[model samples]
Target: MSATVADEGTAPAGTRTEAVQALRVPVSRSYRFELVKLVSQWRIRLLMLVCWLVPGLFVAAVSLQSTLPTDTLFGRWMHASGWAGPLVVLGFAGSWALPLLTSVVAGDVFAAEDRLGTWRHLLVAVRSPRRIFAAKALAGLTVILAMVAGLVASSAVGGLLSVGDQPLVGLDGHPLASSDAAGHVLLAWLCVLAPTLALAGIGLLGSVVLGRSPIGLLLPALLAVAMQLAQMLPLPVALRLALPGYAFIAWNGLFAAPAQLGELLIAVAVSLAWAVAATVSAYLLFVRRDFTNATDDGLGRRALWVGLLPPVGLLALGFGAVAAAAPSTTGSGITQAKVERSVATSFAHLYRLQTEQLHRPAVTEAQLRTTATCDRSDGQVDPTGPGNDWRCVVTWHLPGAAAPGNAVYQLDVASDGRIEADGDGPKEVNGYFLVRSAHADAPNPLWQFDGDVELLPTSPKG
Candidate 1:
């Protein structure tokens, strides 16, 4: 039988009490209605299809490329296993893709009613505005979870079918057995859930306040991008943590053998906090709102300030909470081991790029026999925290040179994993580095200048 509240005058007192009690049940029919309405939409179906298809296609296409797309997390493993395909998409989606997909439904849930000129009629038909709000929120959450499921299934299945279930590779150059790697893939997807939920709440807020599709859809996604750019700035560490964007990539740690989760946990906390705050604020704004005409009334100066204040206030709360509760150090922090890895890996990668530019294919990090040892100026420094006075001595192969050459770098390593180095050597001459010696017929070795090289992070780019 259908579960619903009884009309006050129509039902006997006993029946009314029973109905009220029944209405307290966790899964309300009203919420089911909202889910049906949302999932049945044609665009939602198309989005699910795209979500399922894009990752598999991306993996297959990348497998054919001559070089890996090292800039993205799991990109290096496109050729590794079908299991890794899902993770690659997760990394790719960290920026705008995932947020935009999430916003597609969230941004539309409430504002869409305004767009259709049905807010008044819908509100009038529903007995309680609170119930309607609950239904809508539940429906959006359901869609987000469903989309994530589809992505996971499609990527996993499609990758397994296309590439086969091979062993997976970790970010630290270690390999995992296929059976064990499978669990981490699911966990990796779950890690992204925190940020995805946060974006949904932001979308719901945009819907409640703006009551317009464009603002509701684009604003939250744009804000997410802005948060990332904020992280890139040379701001204080606590300030960066306050913005939810910094934590989006914390899942990259899950792929590690032991799984470094301290940073990941902080990011999850901040993102969940944002999600709860945004959803609650959106609900409050929605219940208090006076729904008028779709085109003429609330679209203008009427709704702007009312709708704008909640999000701004929410951001302020996030910033303040992070400042007060989160540590001054947001990331893993700079360490000697990390510095050595970054310098060696980046130097190798940049050297490869340099050699490619010089038309030398034989030069590789392995053939170059690259090795590095790094130390902070203060020999007894803590393994973590920012340090400007880092030095790394590196030795590598240089063709036609009597012996291997060395580069001494005075490095400045930031907490965010960006490295800058000043070097004095034959390899790095006037900010230029040699890649290869001249062929038998040529006169001089080819070199790549500092401006020509890009310093990549030791961490995944997600």
Candidate 2:
């Protein structure tokens, strides 16, 4: 990582500049230093322990469950296959758990020097804040990547040992042979890694801005919390489509027969974009700022405040603008047939999954026979492609039940073609719970099983 000093005596002014730059020391050296520090830190040591141990424990606990948990994307497969265990843990990891994992190191790296009042001493030894920031950020990212790897490996191993490597089912309920399932599960874990890096970048930005450990940690965690909350809010589908974390759903599509390649690309692009932007901004701030806390002039204080607020403020304004400008009911090019077909196909696929949990006689997709007519609203709106204002009167029959009357589904479709549907169907339209199978002992798998299915009609008919 060391750079050789340039010979300035026989060289031009540019060479002198190169020499000066070369004398600045390598960022890799800083990275190595940070890595050593991370390994030595007691809290980090504890975090590593938790990361490896928790997955094994979680998988073990899930193994004891008696019934399929049909709620999550891969919950039913939890006990059915070891592959499902990591996917399930991935769902939980995206929450507060992930932020804490990345932020703990990122948020503390830069800010710790300021908090400990060791900037003067550290700078004397460390050359520049640029090198320090690079090393710390690299170390944080490395730690997070390791944690992600550990969790995936441990969860998969734990599930295999405890649950047995049964045939893993895709999100669409298509059965994947045990051999092919391992690759898909690994890919799913890889897909989840994007947001982890993005969160780390955010943590770095927060740490540099706050100049303290706790606040640095808290800011990124709070942002993560806020994003999760925003995802749950009843907002315009188009606006939600722009959200950074919304890309997480794209991973669910990976478990499908034909993994949603378009969604996966978009998700990775958006998440990586966020990560890059945050990392660059953090690096710029860390490199340029006067961490000595000495104001060269009256404006230095003002400049600091301006620097800190503008990025955050602009981000906030951007999100607000999109939400405000978007229509409550965005237009779509979808037709009645398209809507009906997607709902019918997805419903039958999911409901059959539900019925399996309920221990009912097997039913075919043809048997469900979903009949529905969709209306875009009373305003003569054309439901051509995607819209949040569409409603469908769906009638489908199940075995051993009275001829049920019509059920209604109110649908909201995102610009990305993801659907958020609410309806008066028995249980929930999507992510509905099914009664556990008879003679199951431990926790039922299908209990309160809610699922996610992002719909972009596979076949559209006129």
Candidate 3:
């Protein structure tokens, strides 16, 4: 009896060791099997093909279009400098196509097994539901990553081949040197993928909760579109925090002058949160739910609502926040006028200094005038010599005041180079003049003119 008991104990130990060894093998083996099954599906193969071919087609179409002028919208959009090239394209795809593609794989991952009546067999043969869920999630994510990689690679390749290497101009009209811009474009594409992972998780959750292949595949895409539309509503600032769209806007950092890291970090965090929550919840629901009754509708209503609510609430809250934070337009127009006047006055002073130093003739009078409130002109004697001639005209608008009437001033310089300032204006108004140099294409050399001006009050009360 002792020998028989020892034999049984040894046998169980050996079996347990073998089980542990099997578990120790790389988890990827299970994922690989899932991947093989996924690739074999007709829908997946079609999606892969579409992802590759569509970008090529778009590149070809864009290449055929005539080159646009620098200022033209199409030119700016296609050029490297414009956000249109990489960030815009990637954002557009992430917001719509990536989610749709991920949903296709995730939605069908588990649901297809049920639809084909393979779930029962799968459960029996698969050792653990957790392991199966892990493998399936891995497979779905792998597919998404592959799709994103293909699209990014093809688009970059196509863009390079079609648009020869050129310094990309930035949104602020500054040129981004060729070498640096290329690196930024690549980085931007990678950052865009961060958000799509959450989209994959969302689709995965939908697949588990709905247990219907079609619902799983389409719901995430629909949800993305719905969120996008809802984010447009006038909402409070805090609510925007919940929007997926906000994550997308974070991509703007990649194109910023110094590169905005703060917003990008926030987006990365939010995206990861969405992915983890969706995936964990999906796993929990799948493990706890009964699969024994194949005839019973796959998911209960409660599970569906649980899966759907978080993202929906996030969307609504985001929309409300954005609307609330928008600027109120109480006195925007008046404020704008004041700001414009300040900028114009600064420009006038700078122009006057440059012309006086560069030109031979000295300015005699400078006159500033406005039709509605105040108008004035003035001239100054040439300190250097009597022969030098100088004259100027200045137009200005008061703070929070409408633009005044048209005012003109002319100057006559005598043979000796002395400027005799004579213009239609009061002596006090014409005492000092603002002078500006003539444009390169002007009719005469040393052309002088009055700078346009606006008088702004020193304080808001004025």
- Considering every candidate listed, which one attains the maximal TM-score? 2
Query: On residues 108-195, what C-alpha lDDT tens digit does candidate 3 reach at each position?
Result: 7888877777777766556567778899999988888888777776666666666656666433223467787778777777776666
Question: Weakest 10 consecutive residues, lDDT, candidate 3?
Answer: 448-457
Q: For every model shown, what is its TM-score relative to the native structure?
A: 0.70, 0.72, 0.63
lDDT of each: 0.66, 0.65, 0.55
Candidate 1 local Cα displacement, residue 73, angstroms: 2.2
User: How does model 2 score by TM-score?
Assistant: 0.72
The candidates, ranked best first by lDDT, are 1, 2, 3
- Comparing 2 with 3 on lDDT, the higher-scoring candidate is 2
Candidate 1 local Cα displacement, residue 94, angstroms: 1.2
Clashes of 1: 0
RMSD of each: 8.6, 6.9, 15.3
True-structure lDDT of candidate 1: 0.66
Provide the clash count, candidate 2: 20
